[model samples]
Target: MILSTLDLNPVIDLTDEQFYQLCQANPEVKFERNANGTLVIMSPTGGETGNRNFEIGADFAIWNRQTQLGICFDSSTGFRLPNGAQRSPDIAWIKQSRWQALTPAQRERFPPIAPDFVLELLSPSDTLPASQTKMQEYINNGVQLGWLIERKTRTVQIYRPGKPVETLNNPSQLSGEAILPGFTLDMSLVW
Candidate 1:
């Protein structure tokens, strides 16, 4: 969905604690913060986007459950990236070792670590440029792999560290590669 940015610069810049508290106070809303502390309020997705997201998330959840090699997180999970931006991808996965390294408190809150893999599914109100920018931000913050899926265009933009993005058109499936071995996403469910 299209995001609305709230600039709380001179008025009152929200500190990390304040942002966390704001999120806590409004449990029904989804929020994200950029490196510059600009608050991004995300709109709720339509039914089609929600269904596709759930299907994709379920695929990742099942893979992670079987592999037990990492932790899978849904859209509700927020992460504090190295760049100091708090983001919540449509789906996220972090290596088991990395997740275990965090303390209980860290795990309980928005974990201060980037996910190894992230996926963003474009909704009707979502813009391709915005999604691409978000994916690049993920890579800059040490995300190993990211996928920006635009269902309307039947395209996938793959992001990786130090590598140019690879676009796939109407692929039958997507492989997890080295990041998520033995995992494959069924495009049928996404379509």
Candidate 2:
């Protein structure tokens, strides 16, 4: 929903003023601001596709048990853009400690920063280059790693800090690596 004022194309250009105008137009959107002045926006991404939900659910059921960090979410989670804007990732996770630091009042709504790890499952509506830019936005904002899962190809792009992105097609195990040490993501179950 943070893309409301901007284009979701490869350029990834949007203004905060336009974003607020869109928000004023759409009451369905919900916004949250963190202590650091970061903002998160959550909006219904349109009607859900039942099958994708099943895939995401299955992935979470297995992945959450291995890590102390929060599991995963297809529900909108905000990420601070390089330009101080925010974008809603398809799936996001925060380090348990970072989240624990929040006050109960702050936890009532979504937190206003990027998750430590993020997964953007590419829907038919998303553009690849724009999605890549979205992943970069999280990285710039301190996200340790990101996954750009392409549903059509059944592949994923693994983004790690200070390294080139890794493209995996039909990966067997989605390891947490150092960022999520000992945490294993068995994306094998996703359809």
Per-residue lDDT for 7-26 in model 2, tens only? 24354333555545555676
lDDT of 1 by residue, 44-160 (tens): 999999999999989899888999999999989999999989999999999999999999999998999999999999999888888899999999999998989999989999999
Task: Report backbone clashes per prediction.
Answer: 0, 0
By summed lDDT, the worst window of 10 consecutive residues in model 2 runs over 1-10
lDDT of each candidate versus the true structure: 0.93, 0.63
- In model 1, which regions exceed 4 Å deviation? none
Model 1 worst lDDT run, 10 consecutive residues:
1-10
lDDT value for candidate 1?
0.93
Q: Kindly report which residue stretches of model 2 are placed more than 4 angstroms away from their true locations once superposed.
A: 1-50, 65-67, 79-83
